[model samples]
Target: MTSTHATGEIQSRDRAPGELTLRAAWRWWLPPALVALLLALLCRDPFAGDWDALDYTVLALRGAPSSMLFGRTLFIYTNHYAYKLAHALFRVQPEHAYLLFKYMVICESPLAIIGMWAFARRLSGSRQTATIAALLLALSPFFVIYSGQAMTEIPSLVLLTFGLALHLRGMQERQTSFVLLSAALLGLSVNVRESVALYGLWLVVAPLVYRWKLDARTLGLTVAACALFFVCALGPFALIYLFDVDGYRAAWHGWVASMHMEEAAHPVTPYNFLPLAFFFFVAAPIVFIALPFAIYREWRTRGLSPLFALALIGLIANLSLITHYSAVINGRYQLTGLPGAIPLVADFLLRRAQARGRDLRRAFWRVVVIVSLTALIIGTPFMLFAWPTIQSHALTKEYRARLALLPDDAVIMAGGQTVAVTYYRGLGLGRWDVIGTGGGWPGARLPELIDAHLRAGRRVFVDADARLWFTDSWRGAETRQLVALQDRYHFRRSADALYEIRPRTDATAQDEPHLERLLAKPASKLRSLVRH
Candidate 1:
């Protein structure tokens, strides 16, 4: 830690007669540098988890309906476009989209590292504080989790960091382009993931609230720029919605309706964000010390920064928890606030060291840098080793296990894992009728669908639990009868102890003539809000 002025304004550092040497300058970047290298080496495999949604979206882009427009489109379609663009130019394979997505994600780590360092440097006016902030971000488990995976979380976070960095600079510089670019980036971030829109609100309001004396022209410019970006960003989605109005409505309504189901829900806990700091001694050790100190210091001097950042993060997190009752509360959600929080954390810790009359500033910095590197060395294996495997089970199984048991032409009567199923479609498995929830087929419609498929000679595969099947009562009988119809069908386990059934006999072939004929024709794609 190095001392700096109490105000959150960057000040020029004047080194005394005996400053640290050339080799010591390495401390500024070595931590993230090493983490990047070690992560690349340890986890070379395309991240297997949660690749489906992004992958499917990429696939959609390859064959997006001409009717597709932006706002009406889902994340899946947007992701599809990103990949399609890359594939058209980069000549990459679809299965390998995760590879590209991973690189894009990992690439953001360095950007985040640089941005945090710059933001901190601007605020605290201490190179050391900037370095500390960057190091903390690099070693954080939460960011690293998404950085190496194919999910949109990291990309969204990266854009957010970029937007905030630009917005902060815009406030200071009052440059029109900077403000417009910031607004555009914020809009882009929201397009990538709706949750990020919360940060956009933070960007727009926090500044006006904190610095109420803005000139009328600057304020007008900022507001106009933001409005322009918002309209442009949302225009495509709006068009897509117009083209597929009913589909979007159905998807939205179905999602809301599923909220009442008891078996699949869980509660949100605020304490869930602990692991980001708890796991890595290198990165989180600093955050643990810095976060509280920053909050306290900001309360005394820079009140709005802490209040705004914390409020935004806490609000987004709690909202996510309440709506989903999910246990996904993690540090990634806090990425939006990192820029503001980092400087506060850095300044507070550095001030304390100065107040204590510590002459060990250089040594403390070296230790912080060294420890950050060490935490990455320690944490990389778990991320590379355990993370992919864990994610594979959670996110990749459906993507990788397409050939598990079913033939390519077998019509699956299930929901979820659409991308994985589509990926494995090449294995000769038939397209899924996708009964239940986001598949566009509700459980209530399942009995008719199942009978229709059976009458058409289409071998319908169902989950052993038949969780998605429509029944007046919850009973194992429906699935049991369905299974019995197949004199010889294959059963294989899927995640969470569910089994998939595939026909094994000609009787299965003979019993459902109508299904075969209907399924034999190209399946019709009805526009609907797809759950990714």
Candidate 2:
């Protein structure tokens, strides 16, 4: 065993310096390097996740109050103060939010791999087990997909795992410094994503679980330092609470409202964990049937070790959260449970072999897990690249082709992807402006905004992605309104699916019947001039 296990007891090293250096390099550097190589292979276009075009609206605030910008105190849109931190520290323009977002996610890849390795090492107490667990995490499907996208999931996972590594080591070693760092990191992680705030429970229990004396004078300064850092880490939320208590309350209510709405989206029941289980073990999900047996044996025989407590609690907390909320869709939402769940995979493998006493069965399953994961891991990027190339080129080509239909100085109004519209506008297509529809149909302001666009000598392009608007509860009504708006404004479908909202040259009757006829037709694949 390495010196790390004994918690302040160092074993004398008989190994040469070169051997130690090589071991150190492997321990700290190799896993991260491999994760980085994987990310580099798939970081290009058709990136895994996309920026919520809605969230980007907050950039217009420029760190001001939401009330000041949008006339709302709740700030229902999370600005991701973490993302704004990039703008403050790195001079990233709000227009380039996706760029900064992708960069931040990419940066988390190596740290996340290292943290996963350390966490597995601490829990399993076997270098072999640790290596396999870290490999599972690094090769995880969601991790691979989210690594290059502008999203909060992977970033939160990185901080959560790193903090766990620190806290677990701190508990075992009775190291106040590590616990302090862990507290701070966990605090900062809450700011990154509210989902991890429950992880704070681990912070409160660690000291007593480790038997660290509260009355000890030597620990007083350490306690103070810990408190100070923890508070400092929560500085962003604290400021909001202090200065904008009303706004903070509004945000809280808004979040709860959103949770309720999400929960209402799907029929969430206790059985939700069944799918979550399947998702976590997706690489070789059949082995997941063994999870309960392994968990029961570990609990009955070994009891709940403090080492595994965080992971168990984390998994339970996430499941409890989803059980209450209707909107939990994928296993990706439950990723906080993944690091904790990984050790069980190793446990299942180790125990299965011992149960049958057949090395071949264990080895075969291990190969199956790896090969299945390999198929998913390698095939996903190829598909991500392949599907997007065709879809994007078709979409872009369609956008460009309709663009030629408009006058040269036409000012186009778009709902989403204003950046892309602006880019095409640069190629003498038309001027562009965002006319947001609250991710749905434009409010009563549509006619006024359209008239404004026309007054500026620009043909109005009313919809950016009418399809995305149908995802929520407003599907039928919004679609009906789009049809109505097309009829009312005498709009025509260009070569593509969009409506051209130009000022009328002739007063045409509203074609409500034609619009209804178009809607009643069966949906099919988009006919594009470009072939697959």
Candidate achieving the largest lDDT? 2
**Global Cα RMSD, each model:** 9.3, 8.0
Model 1 lDDT tens row, 304-413: 66343633353453334334332232334445445455555655655665455544365346547554665567656445544533444344344445435565556664
RMSD after Cα superposition, model 1: 9.3
Q: How do all models score by TM-score? A: 0.67, 0.66
List ranges where model 2 is wrong by over 4 Å.
Answer: 1-36, 43-48, 53-97, 207-233, 244-290, 323-327, 354-461, 464-477, 484-489, 492-532
Question: Residue 402's C-alpha lDDT in candidate 2?
Answer: 58
Clashing pairs in model 2? 262-327, 263-326, 411-458
The whole-model C-alpha lDDT of candidate 1 against the native structure comes to 0.50
lDDT, candidate 2, residue 367?
41
* Model 2 per-residue lDDT tens digits across residues 246-337: 46547555655654554554467766665555455542242344446656655665566554465466566556655543223344565566
